[model samples]
Target: MTQSPSPTLPGSRAQTLASAESLVSAYEKAGYTRAHPGILQLAEPFLDLSGEDIRARMFLTSGRSGEELCLRPDFTIPVSRDYLTSEVAGRPHGYCYLGPVFRDRGALPGEFLQAGIESFGRSDKAAADAETLALGLEATAHFGMDTPDIRMGDVGLFVAMVRALDLAPAWKQRLIKDFSRKASLAQDLDRLSLATANGRPDYQGVLAALTGSDPKAAHALITDLLSIAGISAVGGRSIGEIADRFLEQSALDASATLPPYTRSLIERFFSISSDPLEASATMRSLAHDAGIVLTPTLDLFDARNAEIARRGIDLKRITFSSSFGRGMDYYTGFVFELRDGTGEEPLVAGGRYDDLLTRLGAPEPIPAVGFSVWIERLAGGAS
Candidate 1:
């Protein structure tokens, strides 16, 4: 059976009800049908779909039949699954979900209410992105918070810049993977700038300890060695995957590094932190200085910003940062977080996940964006 939101979920019953009503009604007015995904959901999908951060925090369990399961950590993944299973998934549709999402948040409650809308199949993606973000802001305003800090980012734009730099695909993948962590991202860039001549000890062993033209034989030999050494794959990763990772890392050359100019350009790109309009200009300037074409990404950012302004969300209060994406890998573009002046955690946060549906079983890619408001955080600020 699925876990449902209770009156005692968070805050006062009345306050929770009011916030739920406000969010659901707001999204419904924008043509989103209500969607409720089961709380006890399959675990494998999340294990495969979510980024490392969320994957680490999931509450995992197993059923009587030995099937892995997890308490729902967020509504987006579940609702997307619901939509994909529906007849109308091929067409554009909007969905609103308000319920308890479980997670191990350390000091915070494990069970809390999250309310949000998901827009799918919209042909005008930039408008859809703006509309969802604006809706989150409007819902927050409905709860009486005004002038919240709105931090925006575009993961796609950063990836685009990397692509323009003519970096290797391996390098591009590293940047995207570390985009959500600023300190780690800087370390990643710094590592790229450092040259390494030959393999390290571990790499040397993986390359030299077992040698064969056939990968299957090499994999068997590695697994046998691991078994003898009593080393096992942890955190749901399989032995085969571990072996593959070992091989990939072993094959990498440590001495190869990026050029000084390219590293400087990367730093400049990430240094952009300003109001939405001006940050867009700064990105353009950086691209020009590097002689890398970034107009397409910047144009989309402009269109989305225009849409946000058209909704009267006050672009002045909205800042855009180049390295501000959340830890969720599915966020392909336009990530934002809304918070009161003094709150440690965001009251509302979300972004566009354009490739997510395809990654999560849709026949083709769909344009999607949405945000969720934390009931406790929102109500706590009000109190």
Candidate 2:
């Protein structure tokens, strides 16, 4: 069974509820219609789109028919799923939600209130991105956090850099998949730079033998070997999965070493972290120096900054770190977190996730962006 938060003092609970209501009211007044996604949601979407961190933390259960279900871990996926099934699925719409999101936070409470807005089908990507960040700041202000620390990043910039590089399709996918995972991304960089199988598994000989061979034949050979060894499976991985891993390894083994210049360019790109405007200039200069085209992505970045400034938000207060990510796979563009001075956890966080609606089953891509306010965190800081 899933655990809920322990009972709080009535006064404290009431105050938190009031704060959530106030946030919901604020979002609604800003033109978002209230949305109440169900408490119990299908688990597969979260398992697929939220990445490993959320999958491990979700409180999963099986329905009567054996379908996997989970207490909603976050509002984004659930809200998107709802929108996909609603009449306004493909139309421009804004949704605001305030409710408990369940997750296993170790010593932290398993359940806590989250309030936020989701704006879907907005084609004006830059303006939408700025609006989302501006609203996130407003959420902090609502909790008396007048100037919360704003840390921002644009994953699209990293994606564009990787795309412009001369890499095999598999390597490009691997690098992009590892972007949200800092440690994994570092290991990838190290392996690419070293161009050696130094930290590889002991089965390097097998990978070497399979390198440059036909993938289907290689898979068949591995399956046959496993069968001959009377091993139908290893650990929890099936024969197909095991074969796929070997194929991936073989492909990696066959690839040429990444050129030192290319590696240096990637490293330089990841090293950028500064004021949004300054970061934009640095990125443009880096691209120009490297003879790569990143104009479209950088233009959007600058336009987003311009939009934010137009809203009267001080650009100097926003810190954009190229390597920073929210660790969620669905965020495709700008991401950010707002934190009070006293705590390490963010009181408000969000980003642009344009592909999520289509991933959830829309006919075509619909632009989406939003943020969530951690009511409990804000209330705790206020107290």
Candidate 3:
């Protein structure tokens, strides 16, 4: 069988390369150093660091040398790995790169240059989140957009609320992963509840068994659950793999359940204004009255609002919503998407992924966040 090429991809690779260079120049001017050792990278590190959705979205290949490789879809993972493995550790570093990332399409195969930065080894989360947002704004402005709208959300609060509810870790993970996708989350919750009631060890039961302080017991229980669930270690994580993680990690406080309207309200928040300051106030009030003790997330929200205000961004020109979660599995806090005024798809998107670097084997957790503007979309809309 013969397959035809996709027409949506650029006819000339040079155009993509040129666009990528422009983005690279913009990021570099904003203090992101260039770090292009090699355009190609070992795919697994990126897949491991990127959220599940990103991994799924990539176009992978196997080298003739028998190593698995991929055309990099996002730059942060490779940038992080390069920095961590290099002499750049123990000190803060920022690097930007521009390169083509490949993705297969049945009818619209495409490749585009991705330009972004990874701020490594810094734990000032507010600073990191702010810098990422600032860079995105700067990059957009450099691209000549007069007033690129920015929308934001906080996944840390979302996770905190989930943990505070005292849901089992497995249930929490499943719910967290699906929070942005309402129908799937609802269905999974129903399915897990059914499994728990039927005496089969669903994800929640697996989590409950491993929630105690005993590491040995947790490992044994996880092993048994894996065997029972018929899941195996693929790429070093079984269905039970994250269960063991639950045991090793300190449990979150459960003194209060987050407001019932939290999730639904988040949806509404996204539906509202892009005015950063106004959004912060709305979120604060919601968290306060809901008794969610939003203290942990409020600072970042305030900082962002203050930044927007400081920049003299028109509150009326932006729409802010407390509930605009972009449904990635790894976002920890300060999530957002820059949408066209019509609000269909995010032209630029990212947020706090503090825990992701650690999950991918950084010695200490690196509080990190960066946004990728869909260059093609941005350029297309402008044209």
Top lDDT model: 2
- List residue ranges in candidate 3 displaced over 4 A: 1-20, 63-67, 188-274, 342-344, 381-383
User: How well does candidate 2 match the true structure in TM-score terms?
Assistant: 0.90
Candidate 1 whole-model C-alpha lDDT, 0 to 1? 0.80
For model 1, how many clashes? Answer: 2
Error of 1 at 107 (Å): 3.3
- Residues 165-250 of candidate 2: C-alpha lDDT, one tens digit per residue: 99876678789989999899888878877764344556667767888778788889999988898888888889888888878866
Superposing every Cα of model 3 onto the true structure, what RMSD results? 6.7
Candidate order (TM-score): 2, 1, 3
What is the Cα-based lDDT of residue 285 in candidate 2? 96
The deviation in Å at residue 244 for candidate 3 is 9.1
| Candidate 1 lDDT by residue in tens digits, 102-174 | 8887886778778888888988977888888878888678778867888888998987888887665656777
For each candidate, what TM-score against the reference?
0.89, 0.90, 0.72
Give lDDT per model, in order.
0.80, 0.86, 0.63
* TM-score between model 1 and native: 0.89
